[model samples]
Target: MSRTIDERIVEMRFDNRQFEQNVQTSLSTLDKLKRGLDLDNAAKSLDGLGDAAKRCDMSVLGKSVETVQAKFSAFQVVAMTTLSNITNSAVNTGKRLVSALTIDPIKTGFQEYETQIGAVQTILANTQHEGTNLQQVNRALDELNTYADKTIYNFTEMTRNIGTFTAAGVNLRTSVDSIKGIANLAAISGSTSQQASTAMYQLSQALAAGKVSLMDWNSVVNAGMGGKVFQDALVRTSELLGTGAQNAINMYGSFRESLTRGEWLTTEVLTETLKQFAGAYSEADLIQQGFSEAQARDIAQMAKTAEDAATKVKTFTQLWDTLKESAQSGWTTTWEILVGDFEEAKEVLTEVSDAIGGVISETSQARNELLSGGLSSGWKQLLDQGIADEGGFIESIQEVARESGDAFDKLVADSESFSDALKQGLTDGVVSSETLTQAVHNLREKMTGMSQEERKAAGYTAEMIEQIEALDKGLQNGSVSMEEFTEKILRPSGRENLIQAVWNAAKGLVSVITPIKDAFREIFPPATADQLYSLTE
Candidate 1:
């Protein structure tokens, strides 16, 4: 059965081919098993080669082992590559899951949260650059989320209030710090956002109108008077002065100081007093000038009596012209008489006659009557009254003029009644001798005083006293209201007594009716008692 050399060579080549094919098959099975992570199946497939070897010729065994060893080395390379690819894919999926839960919601919920997202991105980048662990990044993200939620809530809540502030010329969103400050102010004041907005707006308007300066505004707001009460006081002061923002500010200061001092002056009274003082000072200056004494006196009187500055200036000018003309005529007449010129005297007399007619036409009845006929009538009255003529007739007239000016100055400075009377008389178009006399009489009466007991005896009641006291308090506090006084003080005191009487009557009625009720109840069941009560109703 032994073959020849050529046949043996051919058969050996066939055996080598078969061994290569089996090794290729085994490598393919290992590839599949490695993909499935079935290392045990791959080992068992390699072990199965022993059974295949028993069937093969013993001569080819060395070649078969060499071929199988080469394929197994190839299989190890494929297994490592597959495991690496799987690990990379799992890491990518984990990252996508984290982004879907956290980052996606922030992007969708708030467009303004872009800045917060950028902040978080920077944090993550820094953490990665520093080689931080996942736990550190997670902690940082949690803190950022908390801060972002709070910031968004605050911004949404104060949106309307911020709009109001912006309209009033304040920019709340200029910085994160400023926005936080506004939130704190709202919280500390215990004010609703709308109320804070309204208060700030009103304060801004007051400043713009020059009703109060910035410093005063700050003081008033800090002092807790930032609402309607503060606004009303500023408005009232502006209305009264009618000019000069500074003047209003000064008046407000005085008004508040007066309240602190317990001085109760109505706005009307305070305004009138200030006007009178200003007018009096102006008139005093005119007298010091070389104006004719009578003209100066009339100027002072008009200035004190007129309601407005324009009216005061106009009325004074009119009276001054009349007095100046009469004074010039008197001087001309005196000079002519002194010169002993008969012809000049006649000319001067004619001029004086014309001035008298002009004076009569220009003045009210009382002043006209004083100047009737000529300067002679005025001189005759002065002589008849025994007024000393230490100088001469001309000097006597000058003296009389000086005395009239002095009288007006004294009336403004010393007598409040004279100032009030003069104002009333001028307004009524009754500025005559009788009005002046009455003003003097009024001044005298004001100087006299009455005790409280005397006032009460004269018919001032307890209720009237209470009302007066309440009004005084209200004026001092800048809350001038009769209704407030009646409700807060008068009614409360009086109602207490009335309530007590009513309560006593109710108790007495309960006692009187109790026995009759008991007698009915003794004869009747509870149902009968209910029926009896229903009958009464």
Candidate 2:
């Protein structure tokens, strides 16, 4: 490649250029190799970082699982405690509900009240069916119960006696009256009412068949005493010695048989038989025969005549005859029984007044007004126009009072008067501002006249007295009507409000629980929600 001087320089330059090019090529190759080695080291570092990232991810996953398990355990504890509390509360509430519903005294009272209501309804319906009025039926029943209680006989026994009389073609009213008459005779005769009733029934049958007459035995069994003869004879026989209780009962059977056979025996025959038989028996024997020791001694004395024997024993017949005579002397009809029995009439008056007064004093303005105004007016009219010929002054007053009382009872028992709509209207009228103010003023005046001791004795508490005074003050000051004042005082409060609040809350809780309960019901067995809801109510 070298030449002569110039050629040599050119060749040398070429050679240098060639050598420099070679050097540059070699340096480029070394730089390329260094770049390859750096790439490999970077790749190895990236592989190590990926492995570390995988380990960190596994550690985080394990920690998350452990936290979930710990939280689940805590939730289980809280859930179990809450569920246990709910179950215990439900069980206790259920027990209390059952106890309160089943065994409370109020439950018994409600049951008795329902029974009485049903009985009243039945009686009403029965009265309608029997073509009888409720007042008459009720009066008859009342008389039956009253006499039965007085005579120590069950009312059913008297009713059965009535049935027997009615079965023998006697009308219902007559049967009832006859049974009552028999009961009265039984009380005097010291015999069971049933015995007297049975005897009377047999006599009724005999009279119907013409086996007996109303004008038999010295007119003892007159028209007034028609069906009552057997009972009267039994009563007289029971008072005779040697024919005391047991023999008198036996003698009644014989008399009844004699009537059945169309044989009418005189009341003297009963007396003569007792005297002849008693003449042989000692006082002890007569006592054993059911005569009292005094009666036995009198019978042992042996009176000369049946009249003398009759004078020894007190004759209820005279009293019965006096009652009959009173009936003839202007005290006719069923009212005749009440003649000469002022104490009995007074008792009846007291009972009737108390019952009617209680009914009249209830909240209905119609009833109260009728009691205070109409009834008073009617009574006044009756008293003013007293019947002069009817018995005497007392009898006339009794008759008028009875008529007024009966009219009042009919008014009170009228269904229209006691209707709910009418009652509401009456209540509204009575509770009006003007009426209540007047009522309060009147009540206050009456109360003001009484001493504190009188107020307390009348069952007014200290708080009630204070409230009354406050109400009066409010009325006088025009701050309130007495009605409004009373309404404010009596408005639901304290225990009542608390009870209402609790009930409302319970109802709200039930409403909220209903949806959840229904949802659960779809998944589980159905529960008695209605029963539970009723308990809640």
Candidate 3:
């Protein structure tokens, strides 16, 4: 059993091997005879087992979990470093602005600076919370969002207070607008406002091209950290501007002249707040973009495998349809007779489906075994607990396939062109493994009505199942790939090769390959194994 001391930790209490085997046995029995045990409950139990394993420090399963956690840790540290840099920049900039607020010999900039202080504070808070890993980052962002909502609200109140200073907002928006407009006319950037307008238009066009939808701007001040911030900024900016202007006016004996600077404070507030808002978005965007890039390669690889498997499933279904058509024609007088005519075609096809289903079930089991230590269990555990990023193409394909049957249809249709190109060698000569498999099942169904004697007369036999098992074994033992095995046993190799190629590449180190000769020998005899190998060569 290759039992290890690690397996004993927090040991399943139940016999580890016996319990797992029992679960599989019960699952198989249900699937074979009764069918489809609601796996969610069982999967949950498996995950609990994983957690237990981890707590006990069982090396076998613990190692797999630790590996995933380690990768997450690595990503986290890098992310934390990124956050640290951003935080330092924001903090330094903020303190300088604060100093300006305090040191303004005239005390004039204080009010406008006041509106922006919360924005900096909000950013600092978010930066403080953000972690390096996905889970932690997400939680931190959630907290940041709470803070942001308040910050934005603070700016919003500041805006309303500053709203009396529309002249200021207009001037600021105009300055930005003018530059953009001229840039649009210039086709990029220029010295003139007209050219700048062109640039503005171009930027607008670019924005329009992206098809963005607008969310209400006034949702601020309603709830959360954003509202609190806007409230703070609103009170402070307005108070500072009003107070500074009144003091300046009273001191300078110029009441009306103070309004211009007072109004200008509004512009200052809006501009600064907007920058912080954008910065918050920027910080989050940077992290998520990085995360996506990190995760993308694995996602794309899985998608590719899924695409290949879909084609195989499609080909099998298509071939079954063709066989159906063939049965209705001259070569085989009737559907019933055609089925019986092919000997054990009906049984063969059924076996193929059964075989594929079995593999799926077993793979699920093995994956569960590997990840038997974590919060995740069963399929989730296997998927989440991968030490190496490449999680077998089949696993990816199956994950994708679990989503929907339609994807396979598209894959199959796309493969037709490839199949046609290698028609003799791959398409016609090689035959899709899925198609042949489904064909055998179809044959079984088609032959079902026939009596025992008729089935024998038709040429059907149990030998085919034996042959398939032999092939499966070969593939399992690192003997021959699905491609080579399919190419030898079935014609029209396109789907098989595509699947094998993807499986090998996508899985990287996970595939269990079997020798072709030994594979066939398992089904037939030692001699037949060599013969099959030689034939494929």
Candidate 4:
């Protein structure tokens, strides 16, 4: 089996040469495959295999072969998939090129395209027959292509218009479907393709600018408020309300309903009504925040009359400033009278400032009754009743500062005794000689000399007695807050002290009997005082 050593060397050389030639052929095939496909790394791996084979090292050659095999397998799978995807589509080459080149499927009727020949082959393969019905099939395909061509032309033009907007940094994808739907609707509603695309662009711009929300855009489009009408509404609303226009759909609910019912024929009425509605709504809010009902109504009416957003905002600002200044001035005066110094009243002043600011900034109720009638009037009312103490003064102010909701109820329950005392005390000089004192004195004399049972018989209701008792009980037991008792019961009724209370009762009884005597005289013309008094008794 062993020939000469030289013979063995010759045989080995021949085999090495053949192996090198085979490696070169394999490398050539890989290079050709790389040119036809995107297999850069696979070709490089095969090149390395060729270099290894040239070295004639069996171990290195074996590893390179394994690597090349694995790479080739992956490359084959990718290549086959790519080729299949390209070949399986039912669109022509030109159309496929357009789709691929533009990266827009709407440009062509198909996402991927094939030729007419491929389509016929697909039909024949599916039917498992050839030459039969070929003409009919071609005719049907022709008709289909014609329809697809027109549709594609419209879609392509629309998408191009959309592209112009997207090019300006707009994100159409946010409402892509909605935009497409709108475009389609516009097309169907007798708008030219360019017109539909323009309208869609306007809507997209509105959505992007936050002048309208996606839902709002859809709502308008769905309601058939398309073309210039929808565009105008969006632009006008945004102009009128600024960012508030984002909620146009919700704000225009009634307007939309009217449109649906054929009640509103134009957007002008809708916009005007919306402006008025906004004004009224703002006015109502101001009223709740302490603006007098009259002032709020006037401000709202001004907003409507102005019909401009900036004007409305300016008017509101001015009104608010006026209210804030008035509140601050009023509170300042009350603070000065109550505490005698701003420094000493810092805490209360801060509270006052904050309350005023809150009414202006947050549109809260102003609670300005404490200062409305002027500090002098309030002081005269309190001082005339002889409070004379800082604590009593502050407490009286606070009671008046409370909301008016329950103040009148407390007043009705507590007024009678307070009123009577206020009348008699001022007349007798027990209280001050203020103007209120004279008024109280006259009221007290009017109720002089009457028994409780006689007063009851003279039409003083049981309910009135019950209320008076409840008020007395409330004050005695401290069930009623001092602020309430002072503002609602004391200040309003003009009663400053218990001495006034006794005087009020005395004056009340006298008033009842005197009224009875006078009425008895009136009933029996020219009756004497003694007869009238006896009849009353």
Candidate 5:
């Protein structure tokens, strides 16, 4: 045993030679295993232990190489079993980690929240272009939406119509009333908010252009039903002229006013007009009278068949009468009671809307408080079983993961520090080298005897336990010396000793690295070694 300092250098050189030979042989065996060789046999066999046994001369050691190979082969089996268990555990844990991250509840909730805000922004942008204030529009929408929710109306439809009504110069109160009226119309007439808005807008244009008298407009409004019949007449006349509504309104000037005075809109008057156009004049004559060819053909064909004309007339008359009855009865009395009047409804709605808005805001603030770290740990625990926002669940999970990672790191750091201290004790003569070597050997044997579960409970990861076993084996088998272990494994940062080691190692390995550096200084640079080792500390 090379216990004296004089024999230490020779032992180190011999260990280095053996370690290099073992590493080369192991790498070659692993390469063969990677290429689809029989992995179990290759891992267990000692035939791949390299030519060290032959070159070192087995007679001198007094043991045949096969006997040593058997022992090494058993260690390999134990090490491989430990590694396989660790890999399986890591894969299962990784699957759980991925599952937790992929379906993050808070992330999904925030995405939905952002989508709702985006839709609101789009509505606001569209409403703002029509000279309505965004705040006013949003407030009206909330109030009308709440009101609709309490009634038979669809909240989404009413909310949409409120924005449209406000943009078209309707006050918030009238907008709500109009939404109610339109919703009722939709129920009775199956008209959508889009169609109602177009009809109302066309009526406004007709009023603005003096085509329909103010009296007619008020009659349409005070009836508390959408003017679907009146608007359809205008649309039909426009179609007859092969033109848009505005152009039709402009060209005819007082067409709606004339219709209101007579009954160009009533069933009797429309039938009379169609009868006169049916056969009293040619298609050319109707066209000369400003009717399109398609319109003349339709009129002439309708009048040609008495049954066709009568059926069409009765259908039109029944539709008009049904709408008239719906306008008079459907929700009109309820609308009058709820609103009292349009002007009064505005004041009432504004006050009620503001109150409801306050309640909504308070509810939202309370929810935000619970999510924004305001709750106690006990409350948080209970709340975590349900929905949580980004500020709550994600933050909590991230903090726990960070703490677990930090704890694992500390465990590894403590084990490394303890090993380093043991090596340092031997160097300082606080313990004899024999005592340190025996201690390492005993630790390795104890660790190897434990099951994988027992090692895990003792805070030893697979990598840490594997390193301890391999280093002890190298020491006991004369494959690695204490000097190599100290220099490579411990890599001590004691300044003077580190500088000496670097200088000695550099002299042997990099003596001819640079001709200029060699000529300028035969010694390694202390400045470079200090700079390089500073990072370790």
Candidate 6:
């Protein structure tokens, strides 16, 4: 409807004041949000409390943020409609003002012009959604985007402000940067351009350093090496080696089937090797088989020693086993010995068998000494006598030597099946479950002690915030901004008002409950998590 001069003046003044107040209110909400977020979290003492709040959690804060976004979008639509009307009004008013030329009509029209400017600014900055201009009739959508940006920024500067402003991320690049994901996560935005840039840089640095984002690594087996001992073990066991004693050791270990390699074997090597091999057979098995690694390097060496022994006891054992089997069967020993394809081996076995009586005497003596608690002295005596026998007792002595040598051959042969094979299996396991499990346990332990707020903040790095601040400043200075101050209100700082509202809501909840908790912590001084959560009826 056409209005009188008085009516239009009143309308223009009222709308201008209201717009200014809305700007102030938006700034106030942002300020309160910052204050609430920064509140000291020391009073929060719940174990596993940190899990209560997550940056990615789309709960109360997130839902509220979405509501704000929807509202802002609606506000954009409303502004567009208003701008279309103002543009039409501006044309006719300009003509009428020019025609009247009287101070009254000119003054009324000037106020109208100012109101149109404000309307135009809102439409230009915020008149977009789904490829449709909210101000459907308005022709200056681009200009409206620019104007909205400048207006919001000017308002931001006027009431609420983040650290020095700047342009970041894509202001230097063409096309509007997409932040739909961010909007979905946060209900309100207080992140300045510089803060967003700082976040980007932090994210970049984390990537460059080969860190998986928190989201990416949240489910990782070892939290990307954050576990204490597990982390150290991985580094120690998996890191590439350079030339040094450590490197040499690692190489030797690897060659010897250890996680790390070593250049040379030592006494420790021999002991560990022996212990590991001993694991495969019971001591009873060793006694029955008469195997020992003490006398030979290989099965061949042990076999040779057994054959050369004075009494030939060990070789005779193989013969007795053969004889016992042959005797127990319906076979004739002579016939088998003469006609069997294994005859040469059987003939040699008979010769060793002839010496068993002599070897048994020496063997009995060694056993007697050991049973009598003189094992060391007896063993030393046996070694001292060696392979030499000066008397006619050489037959018996030789038998003992051959028995000892056979024991050594069997022990050496088992090494392949036991020690070397076992060690090799462990070294080849590419990732250790034991280490990863320990890391997960440790990370959970460390994080569980913090409050929910702290944990939420933990995922957010201040470095990212600094980068965002720098970006905001860049935008302000037009260093990297495609006129961000005029076009980028759907940015980190766009929903400051909404962010503040959420914070205030959280704070208000805190204010109501703060006194009791503070009093309780003071009086009881909770010594345990259970005590902190204790409530009264």
Best by lDDT: 5
Q: Ranking by TM-score, best first?
A: 2, 5, 4, 1, 3, 6
lDDT of 2 by residue, 278-324 (tens): 24356787678676787666555532222232222345643433332
- Which lDDT tens digits does candidate 3 get at residues 135-197? 332233233223222221121222222222222223223322222222221221112222222
What TM-score would each prediction reach against the true structure?
A: 0.15, 0.20, 0.13, 0.16, 0.19, 0.10
Q: After superposition, which runs of candidate 6 have C-alpha atoms over 4 Å from their true positions?
A: 1-133, 136-432, 460-537
Highest TM-score: give the candidate number: 2
- What overall lDDT goes with each candidate model? 0.42, 0.48, 0.38, 0.45, 0.49, 0.35
Worst 10 residues of 3 by lDDT: 212-221
lDDT of 6 by residue, 440-480 (tens): 23333334455767746665334433443443344346464
The Cα RMSD of model 4 versus the native structure comes to 38.7
lDDT computed for candidate 3: 0.38
Candidate 5: tens digits of C-alpha lDDT, residues 1-537: 546875888888999999999999999988987777776677656555555455666574566566688889998999999999999999988875554334432343233223323434545565555565646654655554444433334344444444444444444545454454434343344443345454444443442343445454554455443355435434565555444555535556754544444333432222223223224456687678767788767545533442232122244433443333223222333343555333355578889999999999999978865653332322232223221222322233233334434442333245554344434443454433344355556565666688989877866666655776676677679875555334332343344365788899998767666786766676665467778789788
Reference-based lDDT, residue 341, model 1? 33
RMSD each, Å: 40.0, 35.2, 45.9, 38.7, 44.2, 54.0
> Global CA lDDT of candidate 5, please?
0.49
Give candidate 5 misplaced runs (Cα > 4 Å): 1-136, 150-154, 188-537
Comparing candidate 2 with candidate 5, which one achieves the higher lDDT?
5
Error of 2 at 178 (Å): 23
In candidate 5, residue 132 scores what lDDT? 55
The digit string of per-residue lDDT tens for model 4 on 22-110 reads 99999999889878786787788999989987877588779999999999999999999988878766457667555443444322333
Off by over 4 Å in 4: 1-156, 164-176, 213-537
